[model samples]
Target: MSIERERPRILFATDFSPWAAQAEAYALCLASTWRASLTAVNVLEFQPGMNPEYEVNRLFLAELMKGATQELADLKSRVAARGISLHTRIATGIPSEEILGAARAEDSDLIVVGTKGKTGLAHVLLGSTAERVIRTAPCPVLAVRAEPSDQAGKDSHPCAGVGLHRVLVPVDFSDCSLEALEYAALLAQRSGSSLSLLHVLEPVSYGLDFTLSLERKRGEMRERLTQRLAGFVEALAGAKITADSHVRGGLPADSILDSARTLPADVIVMGTHGRRGLSHALSGSVTEAVLRQSRCPVLTVRSPKFAAGHRRVIPVS
Candidate 1:
């Protein structure tokens, strides 16, 4: 996709929670700014049971769907008046599954979700539906957390704007990281924000093949990162999005957080493979780590269509 192209549409999924409301507001603002359409989806969880006639169950389900549909419809006119194209949908099933299905069904460029950013016991218990959606969605997922309670109470008026002044993008020089950087650059361009490209030089043990000294390893790491950053700069030059790239030696998650904190970014964008089971548990750690510690909102993109020079740059609606 051309970096200059605008975001045409956004898929905003709401659970009707306070956090979801915050997500809707942010998504709607962007839609208006980009002149993009909005497709809002609400996933309803149905009670599980069996009935011979199923009459009562049917009535209950109908009422639930109708209420959600009405709520979305009400939002449509207001959002549309702000220059955003609006559509509403109601589905019954698992939240993550329904959310992903809605994105595919609408051919949305992005998924905007509101999260609590739960910590401690809550974090372990919730396990993060936002993370799951990030892994599964066809497009990028923007996880918006409610403003800190202290801040919210002080200011009755919700914060305004896309808040994209500085964006943090973590890179490993993998194809996935390249895809993420391209998307991030486009977003930075649109938002008129600076870009921070970071690479985490993970420590090497060499196992039993400990022939290379620590100094040699450090030298090798510097050379590899220099080549990577140079190539990245060239790519950005072609797209016209100015960016700063850096290499730091540490754990991947820690380095990502350190870079983000140093920049004090308004947003962070990254890519994931949507892994599951044992692999997912391990791979999901980086995403989990950043989301837990970062002060800014985070966007996660998972694209099966990603390829060198053939990446699809979804507009930053």
Candidate 2:
């Protein structure tokens, strides 16, 4: 995607929870900024053997729809008051499935969703609809979390006082990372923010011996990585985007989060490998860890053709 293109359609999945409310504010702000079409979706999960055709299930479904409709209506009014039109949809089925379907149906360039930010056992046990959507969505996904009580009480909207001052992009020089860098550059250009490119060089200690040879090899690797990162930054020179590069030695996810917090970035834009099932379990996901723990919003983009240089850059609106 050309970095100069605009995002015309944005899909927002909500459950009407406080976190979703916070995400709505971001969606609204983006819609207004980009003058993009906004579509709000709410999924109504259906239980097995609970066909709406049955009287009992029918009543239950009806009540649920009624509440959902009212919530959407209220959301519509709020968005409209902000001078942005909202298109709402209610679907039945799995939350992630419905959200992805809506994105495909709308040809959306981005999907915005709220995450509960659950961690540890709670996250593992319950899983996350936002994470699933991120894994499979055809477009980029923005995961927003509810503001802390202290912060929430001060701001009417989590993003109302926010501006994209600095954007952090973690890159490993993989195709996915390259694509993410392109997107982050465009976003920084549009928002007048600087870009921080971080490359974490995980330590490698073979066979328990920290020999001088191994130390020399590690130093050589670091030098090469630094040069590559410089070249990566140089590629964005013509775009007039201010970018800085950093190479750290540690775990990928930990380094990303630490840089984000220390830089006090407004957002973290990175590429997701979109690993799932066994692969996901075994390899885990650095993007997911950063998404779960980062203080700012995280945008995850997965594109098969992203590295081909044939894709058009969709604006972050």
lDDT of each: 0.71, 0.79
Give TM per candidate: 0.81, 0.89
lDDT of 1 by residue, 159-246 (tens): 3544767788888766667677777876766666778787888886666666557669688779888776867766676666777778
Q: Write out the backbone clash pairs for model 2.
A: 1-311, 1-312, 1-313, 2-312, 2-313
Clashing residue pairs in candidate 1 (N, C-alpha, C atoms within 3 angstroms): 7-315
Q: Model 2, 149-203: lDDT tens per residue? A: 4343134442475556888999887878877877787667656788888999997
- Displacement of residue 296 (Cα, Å) in model 1 is 1.9
Where in model 2 is the C-alpha error above 4 Å?
A: 1-7, 148-159, 206-209, 304-317
Residue runs of model 1 more than 4 Å from their true location after superposition: 1-7, 47-63, 118-126, 148-159, 205-212, 304-317
RMSD of 1: 4.7
How large is the C-alpha RMSD of every model relative to the true structure?
4.7, 3.7
